[model samples]
Structure formats: structure tokens, C-alpha cells
Target: MRLRNCLYHFAPYGFHATWHHLATTHHIPGRIESNPSSLVRALDELETARALMLPRAVAFAAQRRLQKREGRRVPAALHPWDSWGCHDIAYCPDPQKHPAEPLPVVVDRVLGACAAGTDRAGRCLVCGREDWDLWRVCQNCGVASGGRGAHH
Candidate 1:
């Protein structure tokens, strides 16, 4: 019943391999009916990921307000691939290549490379693993058919 209360406050992050990775990594039960509290582990992972950035977001908000006062009404430009909210970050199946950092940081590092222009002229977003089947998972990083890979 307590798990129900916790979940009622949040929406499911949606279905994807990344979601499954979260479930497994966070130790969420393979079957929730047998152990409902394991669901909280999943929620806790989401919360921790989200929490990692709250301070930085708060700082950005304050900086934006200060700029508004200075007649700098324009906001800092975002990278072309960056929308105003969450993006679909990828999960690598191979544990060794999997992103151990926070998802947001991983997104920044991966997409940031693309935004900066790269030496790899023909290669796709994941770099050396070149068979980029657009609208399909990355053969290298397991990124789904969305976000930056959609364009690369």
C-alpha cells in the first residue's frame, strides 16, 4: 500500500530498453506482485537521477532572472538537438560499455560531441561503430531510434 502511495505521485517513464535497464540495475523485483517494495527501488533511482541536477537547475533559473533584469531578455541558446525537456538517452547492453554516469551527463557528453562538430566525417553518433541504421537502435551504444540519433 505504501508503494502505491509513492507511485501515485509519479508517472511511468514509459517503455523502452533503458527503462528495463533501470529496473534491473535498481534491483526492482522481476515480479512486483511478489515484492511490491522493490518498486520503490526503481522510483528511488529516478528520484536520485533527478535530484542530482536540482541545484544546477535552480542556479540556471536564478541566472535567467538576473539576465532579465539586465535587459538581456534572450536566453542562452541550446544545442539544436536539445529541446526544453527530457530526452531519450541510450543504454548499452554490454556492461563494460554501459554508461556508469548519470543519464543527463551521458546525454551531454554524447550529444555535445555532435554539437561541437567532429573529425569523424562519415561516422554516426556512437563513433567507431559505423553501421547507423536510422530509426533503429544503435548497433554500438543501443540508443533507440529517437533524439540525436534520429538526425545523425
Candidate 2:
């Protein structure tokens, strides 16, 4: 089968995730087709192509992040074929950028004033407890608060 055909068959996960799954699984070539050796060789060739693209991918992500930081709008690729390129560029690590704040620290700072009753408007939606900690559930009635679907 053509590589493009195989790609179409596995397109639901996107190319990266599909390749990652195949690499991690290490299944035999015969499992995919009649020609066991050729299938393995084809997989290896695809992997090599992917490896060659990594540096460019990383650089592109870093550039996108820098563009976002500078308050400039990102330019769209000229070609429709390239339009669906990486959008999760913030997940990439850049040496020039400061490390992200730890989740616990952020949560603490956000909830600290609320917990201490400094923000009087902040109250538990479930128990209506003004004194409850905002970082966790309502301390009065044990109802979950502050994350996901919880009302502030």
C-alpha cells in the first residue's frame, strides 16, 4: 500500500500521534502487511523522515511563541497544505523565556485572598461559606470548588 494510503487510514490521530504509537508498539512488519521485511523498511524510512523534520518543527514553534509574546499577529502560511501546522507552540521550551510558575504557587496566590476573606464577594456556591478556602472544596459542606466546572 502507498504511504499516503496508510496515512489516510490513520489520519484520525494525526501523523505525529500515529507514528508515535507505531514506534512505541514495535509490532512486526507482517502484522501490517504480507511483506514483513519491506514493511519494516518502510516504517524505518518514515521514522527517518520524521526525525529529519524535528529541528525545523522546534524552530517554528519557538518563532511562533516569540511572535505571540511581542504582540504581533502570526502570519498564516501561504499554502493551504501548511495551514494546519503546530498551534501548541507554548508547550515548547525556549531558553530565553522564563519558566512557567508552578501550579500550586499560582493556585495559592489566587485563592489566598479569597480564603482569608479579603475578597468578600468570593463565596462557596454550595454552602455559601465566606470563610472557606477557595483553593479546595467548601470547607463547610465538603463540596468541590475552584477547579474545572465549579462555580467561583
Candidate 3:
């Protein structure tokens, strides 16, 4: 399960590595690499792989969450983070910047902040729109409210 999850998440990287290996090992022609047919075939393979892997990944994630909720211990190998504490999945761009807190907790905090209309709320600089979502994306201009644009 852990292996499947990791493979699903890192499929793109694996594809690239495989492509490089085939190009080098089999002496794949540069002309073939540049060909539209080759590109289409590679992309088609990637899409097919994604279709196959996504369902399994979703199932594993759901099972893990369910196990956690049921007070059952998920196997250490099945954990999102590895033994060395490195993330097995690449969901977050910067895990350190955004710790893996519960979704409900994060949602509640965001909702509360938006409800309170705290310092995070402000006008959108792009179009001077006041309405913004919890993510601070302006409803009026669809731009992010940040820096001097954000107001209390």
C-alpha cells in the first residue's frame, strides 16, 4: 500500500527517469524525441498511468484516515512521512511552512478569522475590491489581497 501510494504520487518523476533511461540505453533518436508522435505517446501513457493510480491513492488515503478516526494504528510504512521523517508524498509545496494540522482545525481558524474580519482582511489592490475569501482572493477582481493592499 505504501509503495503504491508513493509510486502514484511520484509517477511523473518516474516517467521522466524512465524516459531518460530509454533514451540513453536504447539510443533513441533525437528526431524521434522531437517528433509529435513520441510526445503524444508519452503524454498518453502519463494520463493512463494517472487514471489507474489515482483511485488506488484515494482509497489508501481514505483507509488511513478511517483507521486514524477508529483509533486503529496505521502501519508505520503507510504513514505519509517516512522513518527518517521525510514526507513520502509530495502534496504540500513547503511542508515546513505549513505544518500538517487537521483539515477541520485549519478550516475553522480560517473561517473564524474571516468572520472576525481581522487584520488579514483588506481591500484588493488590483481593483480596490473589499470582498475577499478566507484565502484573501478578492471577489471583485479575483486578485490576492496582500501587503499594503490588505487592510484591517
C-alpha RMSD values across all candidates: 6.9, 17.9, 16.3
**Best-fitting candidate, scored by TM-score:** 1
Backbone clashes for every candidate come to 0, 0, 1
Whole-model lDDT per candidate: 0.46, 0.39, 0.37
Error of 2 at 124 (Å): 64
The weakest ten consecutive residues by lDDT in model 3 span: 86-95
Stretches > 4 Å off in candidate 2: 1-33, 79-152
For residues 64-138, what per-residue lDDT tens digits would candidate 2 score against the true structure? 789999999989632111222321111112122211232222223333443365533566433356766444444
Estimate TM-scores for all models: 0.47, 0.34, 0.35
Model 3 alpha-carbon miss at residue 29, Å: 5.7
Model 1 has an lDDT value of 0.46
After TM-score superposition, what is the CA distance of residue 30 in candidate 1 from its true location, in Å? Answer: 6.9
* Better TM-score candidate (2, 3): 3
In candidate 3, stretches whose alpha carbon ends up further than 4 angstroms from where it belongs are 1-9, 12-16, 21-34, 78-152
Question: Please, what are the lDDT tens digits per residue for candidate 1 over residues 1-152?
Answer: 44344333321221343455455666666576876666767666656644543454455567667888999875543322223223333434333344444444554455445546651343444433565643445555555324443444
